[model samples]
Target: MRKWLFWLILPLMVGCQLGAPDQNAPLPILGEFEVVNGDTIYHTIRDFSFINQDSQEVNNQTFAGKAYVVDFFFISCPTICPKVKKQMLRLYERFKDEDKLVLLSHTIDTEHDTIPRLKKFATDLGVGLPQWQFVTGVKDSIYGIANDYFSIAQEDPNAPGGFDHSGRLILVDPQRRVRAFCDGTDPKSVDQFMEDVERLLGEMK
Candidate 1:
C-alpha cells in the first residue's frame, strides 16, 4: 500500500513540474525568435553608435555584460515624453544600486537635440552618465536603430514633437536580446515592469 501511494504521488509531482512555467526562465528573445511557426532562431540587438550627453561615443559595447532599459523621446516632446520620463526616473531610483542595470534614453528629435542640447537636458534632469545616458545621433541612424529594438520612431508632420514614437521602456539582456518591455506612460505598468526587471536580473545571477 505504501509503495503504491508513493508511485501515484511521484507521477503527480512530475506532471505538475512538466506543465508549470519555469519561474527562473529567461525572458523571450524578442525580434524574431522563431521561424516556420516553430523553428527556433533567437535574435539580438544590432550594432550601432551614438553620442551621449557628455559628447562621448556610445555603442552596443557600452552595454556589454549589462542589462539596460531603453526608450525613445525628444527632450521637447510636449506629450508622452514627460510621463514616460517620470516613470523612467522611478525605475532609475529603484535599480540605481544594482550594478548590472542601466538606462539609455535616445532622442528622436535628432535635428534639434544636439550634443549640447542633450547635455543641458541631462543637467535639467539632475542626472548624468554611466548609470543613465542620454544619446543623440543622425536623424536616420537614431530612427533606424529604434526599430531594431521593436520600437518605433519617425518624423511625422502632424505629430506633437515632429516625430511619432512609442512610449515604451525596453529591457535588453546582457546578450543584446530584447527581453521585455513596458508602457512608459503608465506608472502601474512600470511598477509591474520593475518586478520583471528583478526577475531578469535574477536569471543573470
Candidate 2:
C-alpha cells in the first residue's frame, strides 16, 4: 500500500479495535511524534494562505477556535473526485449550523481552477464561504500541505484531468492537530468520520 494510504488506514484500524469510544474521552491525535526534551511533540499543519472562492485570504487564523475538514481535488477530476465531493456535501449539510466547524478544499489544478472557477463550483453546490471554502494557491504549496493531511495531490499527464490526488477527508482540531480522517469516496467511512467530528467538537467545548 502507498504511504499516504497507510497513514490514512492506520488510525481507522486502531479506532475499530477500541470498539465504542467513550464520549468524554478526547480523540487520539494522529501523525508522527517526537520527543523534545521530556515533552512529546505531535505533527501539526504548516501555516498556509490561499485565496478562497470569495477572494478572501484563508489561513490558519480563518479557523481559529474551530475544527475544520480538509481535502484535495480539482474542479475537473473525472474519477473519484465527484464521489468524494458528494460525501463532502454530506458533511456540509451535517455541520452547516455549527459555528465551531468549517470545511476547506485545496485545488491541485491551480493553472485552471482560478478564483472565479472555484466560486462557481461552490455556488453550484449551494455552499459558500465561512462554512465551506474552496481555495487555490501556488501549486507547490498546495501539494506540500497535502502531506500534512495525509492526502496526496499531484500532476500526471496520463492521469485523468491531468491530476492525481487522494480522496481523504481529514478532521483537524483547533490546535491544528489531525484528529481523524476517512476515505472521502466512501459514504460509510464518512458516516463514521462524522461521529468523530462530533466527538472532536465536544472536546472543544
Candidate 3:
C-alpha cells in the first residue's frame, strides 16, 4: 500500500476502535505540512487550468467556495477506469443537488482524449458542466497534478490500456485541502467516502 493510503486508513481504524467518529470534528487535512514562525502550513492543490467538456476553462477559481471530488481517468481506459467511473457516478447522484459540491475528472490520455471526445463522454454519462467537469490539458500538467491528489497517472507500454494510474477518488475542501479519499474500485470504500463528503460539507457550513 502507498504511504498516503496507510495514513488515510489509520484514522478509520482508530475511529472504529473508539466508536463512531465525532460528527462535529473537522476532517484531517491530508498531505505534508510545515511549520514556519510557529504557524503551520498545509499542502494545497496547485493552480491549474484545463479546458472542460464545455470548452470553458476550469481552474482553482472554478471551484472557489465549493468542495469537490476529483479523479484521474481516460475515456478509453480499459481496466479500472470503468469501475472508478461507476463509483464516481454514485457520488454525483448523491450530491448533485448540493450547491456547494462539484466533481472534477482529468483524463490522463490527453493526446487521444480531446475536447470533442470529452464532451461526448460527458453527454453519454448523462452529466454536464458546472456540476461535473471533464477536463483535459497538457500531458505534463495533468500527470503532474495527479501527484498532488495522491493519485497515479502516467504512460507505460506494459500498463493496461497503455497507461498506469490509480483509481482514487479524492475529496478536497473549500480551502483546497485534501480531506478524504477512497479506492474508487471498491463500493464499500466509496460508501464511506460519501459520508466523509457529507462530513466535510457540514464542516464548511
Q: Rank order by lDDT, top first?
A: 2, 3, 1
lDDT of prediction 2 = 0.89
Residue-wise C-alpha lDDT for candidate 3, range 1-205, written one tens digit per residue:
3456756775574345234557778787877777889988888899999999989999999999999999999988989999999999999999899999999999999999999999999999998878899999999999999988878899999998999998988999988888888889989888878888999998888
lDDT by residue (30-126, candidate 1, tens digit) is 5555455787667677888999999898998898899999999998899999999899989988888888999999998887888899898878887
RMSD of each: 11.0, 2.9, 3.2
lDDT of 3 at 176: 89
Q: What is candidate 3's local distance difference test score?
A: 0.88
Residue 171, model 3: lDDT of 93
How large an RMSD does model 1 have?
A: 11.0
Report how far off residue 73 is in candidate 2 (Å): 0.8
TM-score of each: 0.84, 0.92, 0.91
**TM-score for candidate 1:** 0.84
Q: Name the Cα RMSD for model 2.
A: 2.9
Give lDDT tens digits, candidate 2, residues 8-120: 78866645724676767778888778778999888899999999999999999999999999999999889999999999999999999999999999999999999999999
Comparing candidate 2 with candidate 3, which one achieves the higher lDDT? 2
Off by over 4 Å in 1: 1-23, 34-39
